[model samples]
Target: MNQQLIAFLAYLSPSLFVITALTSWYQAGLRPTAVKKLGMISSFFGILSSLILAYAVYQQDLIEISTFSIYGLGLSLRLDTVSMLMFSMIAILSFVIMRYSLNYLDGDHRQGTFLGRLAATIVSVQFLVLSGNLAVLLASWILTSLCLHRLLVFYKKRPGAIIAAKKKSIVARLADISLLIGFVLLYQIFGTGNLEIIFQNVREGISPLLATATIFIALAALLKSAQFPTHGWLLEVMETPTPVSSLLHAGLLNAGPFLIIRLAFIMEATSTASTLLIILGAFTAIYGSVVYLTQTSIKTALGYSSIAHMGFSLMVCGLGVYPAAMLHLIAHSFYKAHSFLSSGSVIDLIRAAKVTGAKRIGNPFKIILGILLAIAMYSSFAYLWGVDIQNEFQLFVIGGIIVLGLSRLFSFALDSNASIKLWFQALVLSAVVALAFFSLESIFHFFLMGNVPELTIPSLSEVILMSTVLTLFGLVVFIQIFSPILNQKSSFQALAVHIRNGLYINVVFDRIVRAHYHKEDSNSRIVLEEAEIGKYILDSKENNNEEQEERLA
Candidate 1:
């Protein structure tokens, strides 16, 4: 097929899935077993199409098309390595989640609607990623958010789901509005909505106003990614079905960090705007990690972890380490999706084992997994030290400390028989090992060239001494905190509450919104009540009048 036809087919797959879902809904009376099967099939094809598009884009280097015009603005779509990567990932994951959902959401009343929305969402996300210009991106973003809102509240009778959907809708609207404004500002300043042109303009030196507008664009990205203060919607989003959570939190949530990285490449690297992104990214990382440590519910914990991982990706972007960030992003999507899927299985196992009066013990493999993860994580941090001794080392130390503390907390919080505890620990250890090995290798490579930079931390001996001291300090702090919280109800409750409330940050934001919008419409409320009463009264009065008229006649 020609490149244009191939790209068009790839883009249409999601829409085709949606159409198939609707057909299944019609034919199967909304309880369609066929709908689930067909949806999965369509999604599978979508993934295949996306893969083909990825290959085509790789061959072509770049592809662009003017998709449509909206409100007099041209909506363009483009494919590059970044967009193709995201598209392929989304397609693959969406397919998996759809297949999983067949069994997971079996017999659900709104199954057909859910499948349709899921298809639409997948399609919307594909367009959003492929959007070449701000206008296309914003339009697709709004549609994606809308579809997600519908999926979130698929169980409309569930009060929690309803509330969550409302919250998500509000936050999404805020993001959409901010993005629209940013786009308009950009167009005004840059004279085009083309991303390539905007980047060229920025690189050549953009106006202060345009730079500030770009910050607004970043703000929208942050909101979408669930960064601090604006992160409440994501946590509440757990009310959605598990598959939806897997797709949104694990797969699609990376869009924000992806956007930042893309824009970072376009903008002047040393601009204050870029520096602000770095600070925000770092703060998000720290905040998310700390908050995640406090969470109890498995899904909530993963949500916070997602935030932290995204923050880490953003930090890498801040440091102009785009390649590393991309690597991390890919790794995270796979691991996180696997973790969330496995969590559901774990919950089921725990319940079934409980029925048999058997103590559900930790999975032996999980402990090994945790150790491996810890090693990898620490090793990666060490590699960062080779890049910039001072900054990277400090980040590594901070990240290590956070991981250690978090692992301890997880170990303590889990029931003795719970397998997750072992898994968590193994993963942590594995990460540490991996990071350490990579960092050390990088260091060795740097030295072998005999072009080693002056040892900022002194010598190998001093490096060892400093690492040991930091490790000891971290251990001390971990013990101090861990000891007091040892199986205490109050401590556990405090932690659980903090985790449940997501550090009460969402609550605070809620209060601020409520306080400012406190003018209740008493008249409108009463009018509605009175209108109902009047309806009954008027009906009674009309009946009497009719009866009296009949008697008189």
Candidate 2:
């Protein structure tokens, strides 16, 4: 529990975890069940050690352990609040996924190798998150990417998965290269790779050149986090196993935000960089939300939602709400992971129902669930925007309440027979309305003396305008849901198709890579086949010639 011991354990855990996973992989060939059990055992120990180190870090101000440099890069580990939080989450989630994969990947030929890479990824991510210096961070970042790229392609026999894996590789390598370049630039400008020292110097006043270097670092974070325009790779990454998807998209996806948070701390005094972050974050949030509204596949929908949530976190950071952002990040990781796991179960249920001659009946529970989710999302948005019931923002909040009510009414109309659905809808709606009202009243009291009293209740005309707009948006979504049944094409159908294609961003990238790099010629396969035939003919001719010569002799 001492600081020194914690630092030592933190420094040693990554290598030990990887070694343990590799050993298990070797044993899997002979005893698959035993190997899986070993993996779980190793993960349990790793998590325990990480938690102890986290406790030590909380007791001490900071824990640092320095070892000799490797290849001119200093090997040091630091445990702080941010790093400890990330490490603990990764440890716990990776262990759960490893346990789940035992059942999920049963009887797979490459199960051992897949599990090994998974372990390696967990270690690499922990190292990257805990690294004290840029050199160490960059090394672990690249290692993590490599491990993920391999796991992405574990089902290489599936052509689509292979293609997706290749795309992930390209994006990950680009991110790695960007990170490396940023690190070199930082080192050159700051004359050190230690994050703590650099942050101190930056707080004082970094040079213009170093500020430019910081921009590059920000770019790297944006790409790694799957910000707008660079988010194509993340969508395709769903080809990986469900547990991997849960870990990568829900757990590891936060790495980019973590990096941004770190940078925000370092560059707190830099107005220009902060402004850029705000703009990027706001743009990505809006873009991602628009995309999310149109997705059909549940996982892909969640992917866009993840991007949007991260965007919200980034925006909160931009607004100088670090605690809020961190809170939201933690909240999102749990909820999103649960949603994905539930989605996998839903998929299985649908499959089973199909096999039993049961038509895919609409579950009234789903509608109630969707309405509850909408209310939660609405409240979160309101809270983030500083809305109070007594202020002008209250109009928006009230409008949201009305919308929620209307949505429940629609749910009732759609599923009149489901009493459970009606009860669930009523319960959730009442709770949401009560919470929103209380929050609004509190805000109103805070600004009571201000001139914005009338803002709480918009004029009748204004209410009509705002309500009309929201109703239109809701109507669009509703129509899209029932359009197929109505035998009419809805405008939202086109939007859905576009989002499903990921806005053609990947297609554009594929075109650019193909247009410049040139693919192997289709004729190459034909030529290879012809060459093999020619070789056969030549061997036959030589045999005939030998037979003729022997007869002549």
Error of 2 at 220 (Å): 0.7
RMSD of each candidate?
11.0, 11.3
CA lDDT of 28 in candidate 1?
A: 40
Model 1 scores a C-alpha lDDT of 0.66
Per-model TM against the reference: 0.71, 0.71
Q: Which stretches of candidate 2 lie over 4 Å from their true place?
A: 28-30, 69-73, 350-496, 515-553
- The lDDT values for all models are 0.66, 0.66
For the record, the alpha-carbon RMSD of candidate 2 to the native fold, in angstroms, is: 11.3
lDDT of 2 by residue, 375-401 (tens): 665666566656664445324533463
True-vs-predicted CA distance for residue 280, candidate 1, Å: 3.7
